[model samples]
Target: MPKGVYLRRAGRFAWLAFAGALLATPVYAQKRTATPQKAVQQQPAALTIPSDPDDAFVALREAARKNDADRAAAISATLVDYPIPSYVEYFRIKSQMFDSSGQPLIDTPDAEISAFLQRYQGEAIADRMRNDWLLVLGKKRDWANFDVQYPQFVLKDDTQVECYALLSRALKGQNVAADARAMLVDPRYYGDGCVDLISYMAQSQQIQRGDVAFQARQALEQNYTTLAGKIAAALPDARVDGDSLATVVKMARNDPSQAAAYMGTISGNLSRDEQGAAWGVIGQFAAKKLMPEAAGYYRRQMDLGGNQWLSDESQEWRVRAALRQGDWKQVRQSIESMRPELRAKDPAWTYWYARALKADGRGSDAQQQFQSIAGQFNFYGQLASEELGNRITIPTRTTVSDAEAMAMRSRAGFTRAKKFYDLNLRFEGNREWNWELRGMNDRDLLAAAEYARKIELLDRTVNTSDRTKAEHDFTQRFPMPYRDIMQRATDDVGLDMAWAYGLIRQESRFIMNARSSAGAHGLMQVMPATAKYVARKIGMTDFSPSMMGDPNINIMLGTNYMSMVLTDLDSSWTLASAGYNAGPGRPKAWRTSLSRPVEGAIFAETIPFTETRNYVKNVLSNATYYAALMSGRPQSLKDRLGMVAPSAVTTTSLP
Candidate 1:
């Protein structure tokens, strides 16, 4: 969310008027004339200096507010004489004076801003400065100046690849292209820029047909070698040739399968040091399930330099391989050699580690670990808790019964009957009644139809425009079956129905068997382990992994897991939501560290994860609409959700 700037008009006027009234009133006629006269006789008429910087700042702010340029300038000059950084003061002066209409002011000229930015070229603030400079450049049409500053601004390691493409388009000259190509090939751009450059080229149609294969081959070559080297170097007690190994590791990650294949071709070419690195690559690839062939390579690396890092990597792969093969002993030995840091960071590792400990007859230790993680209000936490015999309890709403819900659905119809009826009555032949209806998506339409239908059933007159919109929305993409499934899941888990819909929309677009690149499966994108636990808890025996793809099974398990998370998070829906998106433990950690009130917007804005932040918003917004529609309220989605200021509307309650 963006910050708001408010001008205290009444306060400013009151102070100014009070000062004027005081001057206009005669001292002789005032009741305190004698005291004032005595004070005038006793005191010197010199100006008093304030002891605090805050006072000085306040005076400056007042002067600026009054548009007293001379006083403001004097204050600025005086402040500049002090040793403190004047950036804030400079910003304030610029913000106040540039626009009488209260719009934000950009004080520096395009060229000057670019020059100022160059001084802090590689600093952390460079990105912000560069963005501001770009805006200025665009506004002022300083293409020539922009072309010059572009390369310098992009030298910062953190510069986004998008910046390069923007620069390329802005500076499409032959000379600029050559320079950009040089930058692309530089070792400094090898990090994220390599893939970014490829993507940019692909989007811009800059890469010719012949260059595609060549570029892909080059990427394959560099990444595979770099990945292999990093693994080798990170191995225990192995003398890494150089930083080239780390580079390869990152490169290999970009295209794991290709990198794994490249390892075979480069095998004979690798020196003893290089060979160890190659084995490391194989281990990483196998860990990602990218290339199982890398297993042999990892073993070979272990054979060459049986050090801790290699041993650790080897063991990690062994665990994965064992899990795939269901070899319990290999899983145990592999997990044993794993570093404590890996075990702590990865929930899967912790779960498996506990499993290994349990299988080895260390039940007490295993139970403790499992208990600590179980009852966590997230997928993994819920799984852990379920395994420890903590059953999740879902809360129920008493307002709507199953019969009523079924009746509402029946009225809404499988097609557009409910929508058409609602709209026809809402409009009542009044064509002019309309609303902007901002943020009205398909789900909103469904809610609106539901809301309108309830109103019409009560014989209330609704605006024609709103009714038309509701009907149009409902008929366009009902998502009724999907909505029904989600509602059921939410009800079953005692989760927010709207939030469930939102999650489904985001994760799978209401597709029953959606699978993400990260291996999150089904409507709620439940992980395999989470699904497995949920199935077991529900007394589902002989549950195939493929069962997770079935909507009914997925929703049952996902909702049950959601209920577990809600329980573990102490019934705080906000934390539960966060736990749902980002594992339960992280939200718990975040809550402890940042302790802000868990209001939807505040909590969402403060979320460190961008993905999770947006996820929360979409879910909450979805929930608001769902509640209003399902509950038969004719309230705006934002109003019901407490989004718009309460004072914006006359009534507080949903209609």
Candidate 2:
């Protein structure tokens, strides 16, 4: 063929081939692209699962949260081979042992619960289950099982369970009246188990009508009519139901000018003891409001019978009222009138009682009392130290040998505690650690703390050493972790490093990943929103939310925030510490309410919020010790506290 013709024929074949390829491209592309897209879409779920156990655990948790026992049982059944298998196994057993409602599967309760306790025996969950079982046994009034299980219940602090134990004792012809009376102080806290015990006591005449009426008065303090009614139901002639006591108490507290009317109302209708209690309530309200007339009211109640205002609550109010009015005579009288156990429980009252003696010209007796509590690491203890002309300084500690340390770890309690920590049950671990050391002498506890420190369980080390009554090991009590970062933060913000350390110790106990129920995070427990606001304010843009647990960023933000609060709080660490805990507004409000300058110790004791009150005292007291340790000299806690008084002006600005 000619060359041109051949070339044209080749071009024609090429066009045909190109057209064919174009026709095939979409199908080929669809086949290739669809495979990757489908896999990518599937990858999200698949990628989330690192392994079969992880995937199964995620599903198990979701089911557990929903209380979907059936699904959980199915998922957890095959997870027996996983690490931490006990937790997974619990889900399976829990599914059958508890219904979807979390109440025990009533039909099959006995053997499975026993098996669980026998299997998980010293584990935290076992005791928790025992708590549930005891409640169930008590509800059933199966006294034999309740007794059997009650002795094994390690967390005996459960008031309801305590009540149940009392109920069991009552079943055996024993009078639990004194125990019942002591625990009845907080009537508003009665749950079903406790209320049942109260009913049992009332039916057996173990709880008197007067006791019922007294508790009713306590209920009235909270405006908890339901609690009052519960008491009234148990004792028909108790006279609580007819008093409308909550109404009278609220009226007295909120509108004190009508206190006269309420006072008359109580005396008019209530029984003798109830009337005395009513007067005590009025005295409490009056005292808190700084009414000078409160002393006369308390005196009138005292005249009814010595036991009328004999309660811890009533007598504390008497002391507070006297303290408020500067009546040194009544301060002494009221302090002496307090129950011996009550006075011994709080050093503040002891310190003040000594001061009262000193004011009344009994110098020798005052010195003796102040010297007794002089070395305590608390607000009153520090104040008492100042009264004795001493400052809080580093304590001499007996060092532990390696053999002693090894022996401490070999102890059953320490070994059990380490196991619980390994399981990440910190509460259980700490409880076990402390529980085992309950009866140890000071040196043994220090040895135990050394063991905890050896294992890097820093919190237990501090806590164990803190339990000593006659010994003070400052190094063990306040170990400085992340000291370099903390120092940098203190330097940067011009804040006291000791104070910052003290706050962090209280806030998180130096747990790097500590979080609070209020969503605070890190060692200082700053809230995320607060952290971001702080970050923006200080030009701190070098971190993200994940860095909240970072020692540097957390310390930086915490110290800066603390510095801001310190300035706005008149440079008093007492007020600043309170502000850091509760908020800036509350401390300012609390100070402005003071009619005159008060001793810093008085200011701390008078804080309305119990949590904030304790937080302030503890932070300042801790800083005092830390200061002594850091500077190698005795530090004046009084200088740290200075004086808390009404602000010169109502300052509301905060950083």
Whole-model lDDT per candidate? 0.46, 0.72
TM-score of candidate 1 relative to the true fold: 0.31
Residue by residue across 134-234, what tens digits does model 1's lDDT show? Answer: 43443232455555656655434443343343444522422233434434432323433243333334333454322332233233333444423222322
**How many clashing residue pairs, candidate 1?**
11
lDDT score of residue 413 within candidate 1: 25
Q: Per-residue lDDT for 415-457 in model 2, tens only?
A: 7668667656577567667767867998898888888888888
Find the candidate with the highest lDDT and give its number: 2
User: How much RMSD separates candidate 1 from the native structure?
Assistant: 27.2
Q: Which has the greatest TM-score?
A: 2
Each prediction's TM-score versus the true structure: 0.31, 0.81
